[model samples]
Target: MQHSYRQLADLLSKEIRAGRYQVGERLPSVRSYAETHHFSVSTVIRCYRYMESQGLVEARNKSGMFVADWKIQNASADKTTQGKKQPAPPSVEYDKLISLQHRMTELYSLTAQPLHLGLHLASAAPQWYPCEALSKIAQRQLRQQPWQIGDYPTGTGLPALKTGLISWLATCGIDLEPADLLITNGSTEALNVALRAVAQPGDAIIVESPVYFGLLQMIENLGLKAIEIPCVPGAGISLEALEYALEHQTSVRAVVAMPNFQNPLGCAMPEKNKKRLLRLVEQYDLALIEDDVFGDLSHQQERPLAIKAWDKSGRVIYCGSCSKSLAPAFRIGWIAGGRYQSRINSLKLSSSLITPLFEQAVLAEYMQSGALPSHLRKLRERLVANIPLAIAAIQRYFPAGTQVVSPAGGWWLWLELPEHIDSLALLRQAVGKGIAFTPGTLFSSSSKFSHFLRMNIGRPWGREMEQGIKTLGKLAAELHV
Candidate 1:
């Protein structure tokens, strides 16, 4: 638990990084700061001294402390802001992607230990879930709305869920009406609906390179092609590359994006790109399907503004979900489908009929209450805590020339192995040793990411988990050799 002194120092450190205190600017004296914050002078001194130790500030013999000339280590936004001329969209080999489906179909019948794709989520520990509070809220919802369970559900969803979503999203700077949103079974189904509403057979859908496998599967199943746009780890998908695709690819129906805590890559698009994406949608007279299920799981409580927040012409289809942050079993997800709301609503009704009313009502109540923030705080704390341990393990055990990206948020780490090593082969060896990681080939429609792997670091730092990672590293090293 953070004590008063640590909290004070943390807040000050944030302000400094945000440019509230410029480099070399003198900090207020311990007595003045203590009086202003209603803290003891000793507490204030401790806070300053801690900041000094962290290299956020410095002190001289006769002078007061000053803001240190430090480069903040977690500037994920700044890393990928540069423009690049993207290469032409490459031919994708869907062989590995098809094999993944075959394995899943045979998953249950397999005699040996099933390869855990690690997608079922082990990052948010049981201690973090507000089970008791949620149980009470769920019980109360059932008590209050006994009739809702049996009633023919509304075409969209429970009004209360949409209202709660609107309120929650406002905290992230997006506005939506109930009519603007359609609740689906989960973000996966929401993506299905969005894809159905936006694209037809043989249409091209632009997606980030090394995209989410689920989206790739849906695109292939729907007989749609994906135009892969390259994404840099810290920055995001190249805006220039997207512009090139929009200009050249006339058959492209919609662009799918995950601006916040993107899957596999685990990066956020800078705010400038978010706005630029909106402009691109307008310029091409095309549409965007945004997947932001992981938006709420950012390391910081203050989320970056979503791409949909900039849409004015009803061209952006914004998808959100409670699966990653809240209870996954609840299966609550929704889409704000701009101009495509009617089609998406029709697809949702035809696809799943209606989301569970009890789940919707309970989630609505839980989010409106104070419990949501507290649950998110604990979840992010655990997720942020696990990232470094996994990174350190990879660096320590993995072969030379291995690279790992420090994600700005979320639980997965993307590792770029030596070029000679095939991640899919590594996956085969890893499963034998009881370690399961998603191969990079699964993330893309093409074989471009054959040398990459996405490791699930959602599980806490423990001997078993660390050893599993070490074993994974050992397996990869053997493959490299």
Candidate 2:
């Protein structure tokens, strides 16, 4: 059962997530809202308060409720369909992954190579980083508070950073108290800490098929087994597939998912699917460890509400970081452990102690300066232009059946090479030609997606980018024959 405030929050959240309310829009007044909802004045006020708490709306002293720019939109397709249980992917066992571990080593080594035009790395170009902005912030912080750096930071990050994060996260519809957030090195550490808190070694956790290789590495490092549920290109994990897994796999303790701009697949789950995911997790009593590192990178003006924003039961451990959108060097990421805050905090203390306060303060100061939104707006304009250009290049140079996924957010373009082409082998040949790409095998523990590969598109398209893409397309074409 949900509280009345929570219910109203859901309806309003859905509308906001669906982009019914634009950035800087205004919501209905309490009097009108109360009459329309058939609720009393107090109930309406409570609902508004709840909405404000989530960062969805805010109250101006004299004015009524106004929307915040937190939930901006990116490039999500409106198309949605009822999800059917997909055919299960090849199962992964511990021994098999260990044997195939060499692939991980090889993939990482490739990234280290000095490819002048590296298309394999998903990190934003150095030019894209807000180095200048952060440098200014760092300098100001040093001047004002020289003694601040001497203190050993709290295990739960700096107080100001967490406080700023709450208001920032609300834009994405994830409102929380500062205490709920535990900061770590990056989203990786946040994900690592959250997983360790919820599940132990040898426990099985469900991950999306063709998942983020970084998460796959985390699972392997933790000595856990990764189970696969197919994430369709446009649709995310199907309810039927999740239900099947829940019913069949009793040992499955937690399911780690990225609902927004999901890695490798370049897909964002729809609002309806997000609600369904919550229901399934609740019904099965499973932990939903949500990775939302890419939610803010949407190409649209409206931001999608993270699934955590709709979590009423406190089961979603929402992880976020600036590695994707802001400066990666900041190493600032956090997890709002709804019901598992204490457990997450305990794990944080034992593992990393806490991220340095100086870096956290730098980020906090930058956010307060209002530079993040301005930076994202400029970056997104480049992506909107770059995606179509890259897609055009792929179409021009690749074989007939080769396909690419142009997601509304994130920094990569997922390519499904024509059947029978060995992307890994092609990558090997391409590497020597001064080109790079992320092979699909790296994203999976099983044999699936062998004909698939992902290309990094974090920079603007130009001669070098086009030439590198054409060269890779030529290699893919040669292999297809």
- Best candidate per TM-score, number? 2
- The lDDT values for all models are 0.78, 0.80
Q: For residues 163-183, what per-residue lDDT tens digits would candidate 1 score against the true structure?
A: 888888888878887788888
Ten-residue stretch with the least lDDT total in model 1: 85-94
Q: Write the per-residue lDDT of candidate 2 for residues 26-130, one digit (tens) a residue.
A: 787666776898876556666776766655676553245677655331111123223322221111111122334557766666667667777787677878878
Query: Model 2, residue 105: displacement in angstroms?
Result: 0.5
Per-residue error (Å), model 1, residue 301? 3.5
Residue runs of model 2 more than 4 Å from their true location after superposition: 1-100
Worst 10 residues of 2 by lDDT: 86-95
Candidate 1, TM-score vs. the true structure? 0.76
